[model samples]
Target: MTSTPHHQPILDSPYVLDLFAGPGGLDVAAHVLDVPSLGIEWDRSACLTRYAAGLDTLHADVSAIRREAFESLPPEINVLAGGPPCQTYSVAGSGVGRKALDEVKGYIERLMAGDSDEKIDKELQKLSDPRTALVLEPLRYAIQATRSPNRGHRPYDVIVLEQVPAVQALWAHYALVLKNIGLPDGTKYQVKVGVLDTETYGVPQTRSRAVLIARRVGLGEPFLPEPTHQAYEAKGWNRGNGEAAALTHQPSLDEEITPEPVTRRGKSGGPLPWVSMRMALPGRRKPFLVRSNYGSSGHPGRRGVRTDQQPAATVTGRISRFVVFEHLDENVVYEGPRFSMNEAGMLQSFPPAYPWSGTAQAQQVGNAVPPLFGAHLLSAALGLPVPDPEALREPWVPATEEERAKLRSQGCGAADDCTARCPRPEDQAPPRSVSQKKKLSAG
Candidate 1:
């Protein structure tokens, strides 16, 4: 593992336990900031990457793990963090495309009813898309952790959860549930939920996620972390004048759909430039078309081309579909070169020296919470000092032939190491007898 330069642990309860911790994004951030952390992930490929990175992880299904099992851990895990698989909740996901929201709402209601584990499991078997309910796992774990025990409960001091923007309302509803149900200490958990753009947190990507945070009795209501970086639009940028907006590294496609630019220093001024693709990829500045796996049919969505000057669109699991758009000057666009695994990793803020061992390299990278953004959230949750966005950028360079050989020496691929591969979420036919709208309304 590469050495972390400026980490100072300062949380009331610094130990963090991450659920659905794919590729250790939150774990990486917590650890680098000197917080003791543990990750639980079921995917073998994800576990392999976690292992190669030297992160502490439990290679088992999150559903199978019980809170009592955490008794053996040290420092009394006070923070609970998770980003359950978002495949079912993403706008680009097949689940949403299939119009599964009504069924999803029913699942949430069932979960809220506090159905028995056996019943929930059986219901899951019946659902066409069980992954939609996986979002409840974090809340389930939290409730289990905070229940009064024969022995005094070690209630989590803070809880942080994130998902795609489509799940924002679900998390908001969860916040209300958490508020209604008091912890073992008979204190209501203060909760906050919202949507945040990754670029605002200095991630070199234009991804938006739904965030939910809860703090124990005394801490009061928690707040979402404020953005430390801005891109696309600066507060006072005069579009009429030639003067560019703050951090306008990339050209906007259109005014209607474009994300407003931001800067480190609000409307006034900030020193650092947004970390553009050019800054991260170095030397690969030409424009290019990112071919879609969907081809011309364009069912889910069309693959997009990104310029070196801007943060990239959300990186998807199928990143191989995104080929670079080669071009001459600004007008001519060509297609062909695809992003290497390392390039994707850098954009996600993984350290340059990270040992990557996984079959679906792009999938693992795409699924990760960017470590820089994670750190920003962690700092906010713990009331610690947030790092400067400028300080977060590390130089990314292509692997040399020798480095490639060493990576090979690490392991074949996560496929070989992982005991089980996560399957695509199935679409279960909705219940015939019970009315879907009625069930959702019952909650």
Candidate 2:
């Protein structure tokens, strides 16, 4: 589906082409920065959410649609960004594992051997695994975009990619390959890849992801965005403040972080306190406790109990299972209240009142890149000015009375004394039944 923008797009702004756009997380950031963009997505649920949010989208399989599909875009593409579906590569997923990885590498090698698409398709069919190879689709587009600059085409100026940290090795390999290809101008791309902690970028969640950035030749050295927020665990590993080190908030190990007013905004003494649940879900008061659904199991660890004082653990699609816990002397109970979709969206830095549609609201939120962090990556890719996080506020909720009421309804309680337990059992997905087995896919 080739859909046009629901809103007028700025024709002069740098254009961002997003692949596997999910629910338009990166596009949200692009919009905030006034960068016109179009997302290519295939998932029906995610596309509905994107459309509801008024994002321009083209619904199609990235692998099947090829570069010819993007000919309508400006000749000189400014930015290329994508987060390929990561089912087979996620540590949480059980799939073809390392074997699938090797098969993908073999497939790429054969393609380089001048193997025809029909032959490759048949061979991939025999392997019975496709998602592992899907990760290379972005690379395919990049190569095609820059292949004929001499023939009146302009290569994309910047490229950005992200995936689970487990896929870091794959990205590093791509970085090397991208560095070797000369564009029409005889300059190669400068590439860099590393694991980025979302908390360090003000995402309000401690999700670590593999990030890759590449700038076309002549744009100076490629570099990752510097961390804009202080990490809670900084005291353990970062000890000294050398001259060359970028400034970061490093609390003393003995220092204590008490809960501040949820309304309190702006930085106090150091980099803005790593965003916490309190700031993201202001309705939930102190001593906040979380409980998992029916059959959750895990060793005692700081996984389940999310306090307003700390950033949340990585949010997964199974978030509904985790709820607020009420403790009273010897009795512990959960009264069926769970974190709302709005709260989850805030944790992911999505705009307030984001029109999240479809039954997979939680899944869409879980899969998106945090918009605040995404803005940082985009800025780095385009060598643009970094956006002030404070200036980027959610458009609704807490601010909107009607939305605030909805958020309150989903919370356990608003009492200051109501807090979740610390270190509750981790909520792992139940094992899939034989009937649940299907081809792998990514968000």
Top candidate (TM-score): 2
lDDT values for all models: 0.62, 0.63
**Residues 1-443 of candidate 1: C-alpha lDDT, one tens digit per residue:** 01112334335557888998987788778865778888877666776677667666776657666533444444377788989876665556444623555565565555556656577677776655566667777866666665535325667788898877777777777777668855434556788888777776677766777888788767754767766666444223222221122224334333122223434465555534456665555535443333333321121221233345556656767666666665443454555478777777777776665556667778888888888888877877777677554333443233454543343233222323332223212322323334666778886
What TM-score does candidate 2 reach?
Answer: 0.73
Estimate, for each residue in 319-421, the C-alpha lDDT of model 2 and write its tens digit: 6666655323222333435778877887788866787876688998988988988997887777666656654464732224443333222221221111242
TM-score between model 1 and native = 0.72
> Which pairs clash in model 1?
128-427, 128-428, 230-262, 232-261, 233-261, 233-262, 287-325, 288-325, 288-326, 289-325
Q: Which ten residues in a row have the lowest lDDT in candidate 1?
A: 294-303
- RMSD of model 1, in Å? 9.5
lDDT of 2: 0.63
